[model samples]
Every structure is written in structure tokens, then in C-alpha cells.
Target: MKSSDISVEAKGVSKNYSSVKALDDLSLSVQKGEMFGLIGPDGAGKSTLFRILTTLILPDSGVATIEGFDIKRDYKSIRRIIGYMPGRFSLYGDLTVDENLSFFASVFNVKVADNYPLIENIFKDIAPFGSRRASRLSGGMKQKLALSCALIHKPSVLFLDEPTTGVDPVSRREFWQMLERLKTYGITIVVSTSYMDEALLCDRVALIKEGRVLSSDSPRGVIDSYQNTLLAIWGDDMHSLLKELRSYNEVKSVYSFGQEHHIAIDKKLYNHNYIDSLTQKLEERGERNFHIKVIAPTIEDCYMEFSANKEGYE
Candidate 1:
């Protein structure tokens, strides 16, 4: 992509905390007006990378830019053009909803009234509780309030680190809906999430693990890259079935996915005879009421596959 089309860019970025390498030669870019996701679990260096991009901390090596401004040399300018909502609730607990909003607005040398339209949809939900202290607001309400504060300055880029984490299922759904609406305003949203399912909501996602990127592609692209034949198998005794599947020489990998175990096998080895052989083995092991069927891979399945072969990506 053209440099002008890029909103955020990182090249060989690395960070270390004494002996711990938080980020190891990481590199990725975010396009302007695109909602990009960093999909990884905790300790995967998501927060570390956010801190570096937002100017909260510096990286040990490599270079990065925000809207063409070098993060190291143009931190002040970068700060003026971006909004960051950290994973934790950092607003003042003693302040009321309206008070918190006004405080953040004033910090950016702008009035809440001036940008009221930008945050109206989110603020409207918490308006009735304007008098309530931030600490007293429910999890979902607090999330909305934080998002409103972040957008008060009309930032061109917004960095949300695990915004839906710890919130209810319904609230998570609502938060994603709000993000969808924000894209129309032409804001580049860089969000990090551990939820594999949430990766589908982004324009593209980078699957990270142990301070390395395993894959970076559109959600469908990542799933389509999976090479092994996948199968969803379950039986009356899930624990025993899992063991039996793992013991099979032809099984490449097996992991418990919700109520069933998802198994991957070599494409050449996956056939009708293989399925029949599996059935006979399970039946001989006293397993009854068992079922096996071919299944499409999900984002989580792709993640597991990449993680298993992370050395290739790193």
C-alpha cells in the first residue's frame, strides 16, 4: 500500500523488560480509515505495542510512525491527533460522568459542546447517569463513557486496547456496534482483542503470540490458508474420546473446542476409510453414541494452527 494510505506503521519494533522480551522484531501497518485488530491472548505484547504507538513508552529498537510523524521525534504532534483508551479504566473515579467528559475535553483544549455530535450516540446512553460517579457506573456504561471521552477531541486515529474485555456479552456486542459506526467518520481504529470470534469483525487481523506475529490477513484469508482437513468429533465420554483421538498416529492435532474436540489430520490421510477406521477403534474402546463430521475452520482454529508453527512466521 502507498505510504499516504497508511495511518500507522511499525518496523522491526522490539521491547524488553530486563530478561523478558515483550515484543520481538514485530512489524505491522494499519491503513487509514480501516479497523485493524491485533488478535492475541494476554502477555502477547499487545499492550506493549499500543504504549509505544501512543507515546506512553518507547521501544528498545526499530522505528514507528503515526500519520507520517515519527513516534520518537514527533510525540507531541502525534498525541494531538490520536485518542487512546487503555485496557483498564483510567478515568477519575471520584468524578461524575459529565465531569469526566468535560475534564478530558479541556485537557485537549476543546469544549465538550464543540464535539458533542461526534460522541452523541455513545454519550446518550450514559446521559441519564450524568450525575453518577464514574466508579459507580456499570461496566457497560463505563465503557461508553470512556469511548465518548476518547472521541471528544475528534482524533483522526483511535487506539482501543481490549475495550470489550471483562464486559458482559451484550455489552461486548454493543461496543462493537459503536465501533462500526465510528468508521464512517474516517477514523483509523486499531483495536487489540483476545477473542478469536471478534477477529471476524475487523477489516484485517494479526494473530500474535509470545511477542511474535503468526499470521496477518483478513479473517477469511487466514481461515482459507489452513491446509489440514479438520473434523469435529464427540462422544458420550469427551475425556476418553480426546485421549483416543490424540493417540491415533494419523491425527495431526486435536484440541477441545467448546462441547466437541476439533481434530486436524493430513489431507492425504483423511478419507472414508480413515473415518471408518476411527469409528471401529472408538467402538472397540467401548465408546457409544459417537459422531464425527468434517467441519470448516474458524478464526480460533487458524490461530491454533499458526501458533503450532510459529517459527515459520517469526
Candidate 2:
């Protein structure tokens, strides 16, 4: 297939360590110029997949390719075509932001001058502080600098692993905005994130757990896979509401979701009549300040159920 047809393709890949299976017959693919996301919490095999695709490690079995370059055999050309930013802040902290960017640019036989236009927008924000050590920059600035370096070589494919994990909310939002800009350049971008809300930002997402992909589709498609008529119940007494919700025989599953509680009920046993009865029961139990209503499933809800039966994390 052409690069335009498939930016990435993996078939029945597996990797193991002693008795632990880091990846279990996993397979995934991404189209050229598409911003694909891997959504899952830590230990979900995102890093493993990144390493395999980047040619940092060999898969014990199966095949993987980037723009049709076999990961193992065409690694040199593959490295030239892909820019990978790891989950950790791997940039040299003691080096100035400008220095770090220059170094990476040189590594790929490119210069800061060559790809200046590509990173011009993002670099302007931190260029004023260019002389500052990378260690001193705020999380968001460091993130931008790292991204600038990643693009300095103008790689066709980019892999970012949890790029916003430890950043503040504002920084996280800013980082995503940068990604949106990168997408406009028509480059294939694969990013892994632990935040459920971030899943909405992707053109499509793959929810992975314990080394296997549970579902791969557009964000809306994945969320719509949710089967239950979900409900979010909130109240002044959250603890009591949570306790009462899980104790109810009609409730199939209840998990705390930010400010509200997400619950899946057995429709056969619970309807308007059941909710009314449960509300009355709770009020009688001194949990009187709560409301429950039908709601659509969020990405988090779909991931929870989809990965519920997957193998436990290592």
C-alpha cells in the first residue's frame, strides 16, 4: 500500500518478559496525515508499542511498518522519517532550550535554519527565554521546546507519548492546541495520552489495555459503543451517594466520575419507577439532595467497560 494509504500497520505482534505478556497478539494501524491517539492509563502498553514502532526494540513476533518501511530492516530510513518524543522529559535539562533544540536538529543531519518555518509559531513563545536552561522552563514551555526540536528535522511521522501527563491544566490545553496546528501541516501524528478528556481531541483513537487494543475508531464512535442508558447522579453528600448507589441491587456498575457519579443500571429492573423508588429510599436514608437522569456515555465510560475484561496491568 502507499504511504497515503497507510501510515502504519501492525499485525499480530507480541512481546513477553519471563511469564508476563507485555503485548498479547496486538495489532493496529493509522492512516497518513491522521492524528491518531492511544488512550489508556499507565501500563496499558502504549510505551511498548511506541518502542516497537520507533525501532528501539524488536517485537518477539509479527510485523510492523511505517509508511511501508519494515521497522526492523529499514530502521535507518525509518528513523529519518519519524520523530519520537518519549513520555519522560528526555531533553538535556542543563542545556539551554535553544541548545537542546539545536542539538536534536543536528542529530538528524538538519539545522535549525532548515526547519525554522515549521516550528516558527511554537518557537516564538519560548524564544525570548531561549538562553534559559531547559530545566528552568515551565512544564508547558519545555513541552513546546521539545516539540519544536521534534519538528526541527521536518519528519513526516511524529510519535508523542503522554506529552501532557504531568503538566497543569492550562499547559495541557495549550499543548493540545499546538497539536491541532501540527495536524494542519498534513503530517501523520500518533500520540498516547492517559487523560480521558484528551481522547476527544483525536480524529480517531485506539483504547488499549494490558498490551492489546480493545477498540479503534473515531472518538464519537468509541463513546457510542456504550450499551447502557447511563446516568450521572450528583449531590451534596457524594460519599453517601456513592455508597447507596453501589449497594443498590438494580445498579450494575457505579464509578465516580469527576463531580458526578456514572452508573449503569439494569434497565429490566430499573426505570422511572425504580429511580423514583431509589430516590425515596435514599432520602429516607438521609441522602436527600441528589438527582439522577439519563445521559450520554463519555469516552471514559466506554474505556472502563471495554478494558474491564482485558488482562491486568503489569
Candidate 3:
């Protein structure tokens, strides 16, 4: 991508805290006006990378830029053009919704009314409780209010760190919809989320683990890159089934999905004869009541695969 088209860039960025390595030479780029997702679990360095890019903290080594501004040198300029909503609620709990919003607006030397149009869609949801203290708001309402404050300055780039971690399912869906709307206004959104399902919502995603990016691509691209043949199997005796499958020589990997267990096998080893042999073996072992079928890989499946083979990825 051209320099002008990139909204965020990081190269070999690393951070260490005492004996812990928070980020290990991590690097990625976000395109302007695109929704980019950093998909990972806790302690995967998502938060650390966000802090480095937002200029809240400096990296131990490597370089990063936001809208072509050096993170270390042009931090003041970068701060003015980017909006950040931390993983935790940083707003004063004693402040009312309106007060919180107004305070943030004032900090940026702008009036809430001046950028009302930019956040009207999001603010309208919490406007009803404008006079209510932030501490009294629901998890969903608090997030909406936080998002409103982040956008009050009409920033060019927005960084959200696990914004829906504790939100209800309905609220999570609504928050994603709000993000979609923001894209239309030519704002670059870089959000970090641990929800595997949410990874599919981004235009592109970087599957990260242990301070490293195992894979980065569009959701479909990542799934398409999965080389293993996946099979979804389930039965009454899940524990026994899992143990049995793991003992099988052909099974490459197995994970407990929501209601079913997903197992990976070499594509070359997948065949009708193999299935028949496996079925017979299970039946002979007193596991007659079971079901198995080939299934398409989901983002979670891909993530597990990538995480298992992190050394193979750059």
C-alpha cells in the first residue's frame, strides 16, 4: 500500500516489562478508512501494541507511525488526529454522561455541538440518561458513552481495545453496527477484540498470540488458507470421544467447540475408507452413538491452527 493510504504502521515493534515480554517484534498496518481487527486472547500483546501506537507508551525498539507522524517525535500531532478508547473505563465515574462528553470535548478544544453529527448515532442511545452518572450506567451504555467521548473531537483514526469485552450479546452486535456506520465517514478504525466470532466482522484481521502475529488476512483469505481437513463430531460421551479421537493416528488436532468437537486431519488422509475404518473402530470400542462430517473451517478453527504453528508464520 502507498504511504498516503496507510493509516497506521508498525515495524518490528517490541516492548518489555521487567521479566515479561509484552510485544515481540510485532508489525502490521491498517489501511485508511478500513476496519482492521487484532484478534487474540488475553496477554496476546494487543493492548501493548495499542498503547505504543497511541503514544501512551513507547516501544523498547522498532518504529511506528500514525498517519505518517512518528509516534515518538510527533506524539502531540498524533494525539490530535487519533481517538482512543481504552479496554477499561477511564472516564470519571462521578461525572454524568453529558459532563463526561463535554469534558472530553473541552480537552480537545472543541464543543460537543460542533461534532455532534459525527457521534449522533452513538450518542443518541445514551442521551436519554444524559444526567445519570457514568458509574450507574449499564455495561452497554458505558461503552456507548465512552465511544462518544472518543469521537467528540472528530478524529481521523480510532483505536478501541476490547470495547465489547463485558457487553451483552445484543449490545455487542449494536456496537459493531456503530463501527460499520463510522467507516462511511472515512475514519480508519483499528479495534482489538478477543471474541473469535467478531474476527469475521472486520474487513481484515491479524490473528495474534503470545506477542506474535501468526496470520494476517481477510477473514475469507485466512479460512481459505487452512490446509487441514476439518471434521465436526459429537456424541453423548464427549469426554471419551475426545480421548478416542486424540489417540487416533490420523487426527492432527482436536478442540471443543460450542456444542461439538472439531478435529483436524491431513487432507490427504481424508477419504471414505478412512471414515468407515474410524467408524468401525469407534463402534468396536462401544461408541456406536456418534456423528461426524466434514465441515468448513471457522475463524476460531483457523486461529487455533495458526497458534499451534506459530513458528511457521511471520
Candidate 4:
């Protein structure tokens, strides 16, 4: 896409701390007004990338720009035009909710009333707690307050680093709903999360691992690219079933998925008769009452497949 259409762009960015590589040859782009996600596990370079894009830290090499402004040269400009909510609640513990909001607004040289329109929906839920110390707020309430502070400046692009990490299920859902509402206001959002389930909520996602980007695509695109013949198997003894499945030469990979085990098998070995053969083999191993069936792949499954493939290449 044209540079004007891009809200953020990272070109061959790399960072290292002594011997540990935090990011390596990483690159991705976020379109204007799009909700993009950096989906990966902890230490997968999501936070490092966020820090680079937000101009909190500079990359050892390569370049990144936010809103057409260079992250290094125009960091001051970038800070003014973008809102950032770090993974942790860094607001002052001694400050009340309203005081914290006012502090952030003052830093941005704007009154809370100036951008109240941007944060009104989120602040309303916490308005009654305006007098409560930030440290005394519940996890969900703290999250809402942090988001309100981030939006108090009406930034064009918001950077949220693992916004839902410590939140409850209900609050996580509510937080995503707030994001949906924010999108209508034409703000570009780049959120990083280790939760695989949240990938579906983004317009597009970049799957990162071990300081590199494995894949970047729409959620459906990633799932559709998983070519493995996955099988969901359940049995009397899940532990033994997992062991037996792994022992089979036909099984490429196997892992527990809730109560059942998901195994990836070679396409050549996946057939109608393969189930019967698998059952017979398991029966000889003293595994009985096991059921096996083909299953569709999920974003998690695709993530595993991509991660495994990347490992093989390395």
C-alpha cells in the first residue's frame, strides 16, 4: 500500500540485548484505521516491537514509522499523535481515577473536557470511582481507566501492549467491544496479545515467534493455509492415548486440546481405514473406547503448524 495509506510500518527492524535477540529482521505494516494485532507468546518480540513503534526504544537497526513520521527523528511528533497503553498499569498509585486522567490530559497540553468525547463511553463506567485511588481499582476498572487516559488526547493511532493479559473473561470481552466502538471513530489500533483467541477480533494479525514474524494475514487466511489433516482423538486414558498417538509413525505431531488430543497426520496415511487401523493398534497397546475423527484447524493449530515449520527450517 501507499505510504499515506499506512498508519505504521516497520521495515527490517532488528534489536538485540547483549546475546539475546529481542527482534530479528522483523517487518510488518498496519493500514490506516485498521485494527491490527501482534499475536504471539511472551518474549516473542511483541513488546519490543511495540516499544520500537511507539518510540520508547530504538531498534539496533532497520526503521519504523508511525503516521508517516520517522520513529527516531520525529518521536516527539509521534508521541503527540499516538496513544500508548503499556501492558502494565503504570498510572500513579496515589492518584485518584479523575486525577490520573487529568494528569495525562495535562501532559498532552489538553483539558480533559477537550477530548472527553473520545473517552466518554469508557470513562462513564468508571466515573463513580473517580475519587478512588488508582491502586484500589479492580483489574477491569484499572484497564478501563488506563484506556481512558490513553484516549484522553484523541490520538490517531493507539498502541495497546497486551491490554487483556490479566483481565477476566467478561472484561476481556467488554474491552474488545470498546475497541470496536473506537474503530468507528477512525483511530488505527495496534494491540499485542498472547491470547490466540483474540486474533479473530483483529482485521489482520502478524504471528510472531522467537523474534521473527512467522505469518501475517487475516485470521481466516492463516487458518485456511493450514494443510495438515488434523484428527481429534478421545479415549479412556488421555495420557496413554497421547503416548500411543505420538509413537505412531503416521502421526506427524500430537498435542492435547482440552479433553481430546489433536494429531496431525500425513495426508497419505489419513484415510477411512486409518481410523480402524489406529483403533486396532491402540487396542493392542491396551487403549480402548477411543474415538477419532477429522477436525477443522483453528488459529492455535495454525500457529503451532507455522511455529513447527519455522523450527524445522532453522
Model 3: lDDT of residue 34 = 91
- Candidate 3 local lDDT, 1-314, one digit each (tens): 78999999999999999989999999899999999999887789999999999999999999999999999999999999999999999998999999999999999999999999999999998999999999999999999999999999999999999999989899999999999999999999999998888889999999888887778899999999999999898889988988888888888888999789999999999887876788789998889688888899998899888777764632
* Lowest lDDT 10-residue stretch of candidate 2: 305-314
Supply candidate 1's per-residue lDDT for 109. 98
**Runs off by more than 4 Å, candidate 2:** 1-4, 309-314
What would the per-residue lDDT of candidate 4 be over residues 1-314, giving only the tens digit for each residue?
Answer: 87799999999999999999999999999999999999876789998998999899999999999999999999999999999999888899899999999999999999999989888889999999999999999999999999999999899999999999889999999999999999999999999887788888999999999888888999999999888799899978999898778777888889898998999987877888887888788898898888989899989888778777767741
lDDT of each: 0.92, 0.87, 0.92, 0.91
Clashes of each: 0, 0, 0, 0
**lDDT tens digits, residue span 1-314, model 2:** 45558998889999987888888899999998899999876777889899999999999999999988999899999999998899888899999988999999889988899989889988999999999999999888888998898889998899999899889998898888888988888889999987888989999999888888888999999887777768889989998888877787777678899899998875566566766777788898888678988888888888877765464541
Better of 1 and 2 by TM-score: 1
Q: Residues 216-256, candidate 1, lDDT per residue (tens digit)?
A: 89999999999999999987899989888888888878999
Task: Provide TM-scores for the models.
Answer: 0.96, 0.95, 0.96, 0.96
**Residue 155 shift from truth in candidate 4, angstroms:** 0.8
- The residue-level lDDT of candidate 4 at 241 comes to 90
What's the TM for model 4? 0.96
Best of the two (1, 4) by lDDT? 1
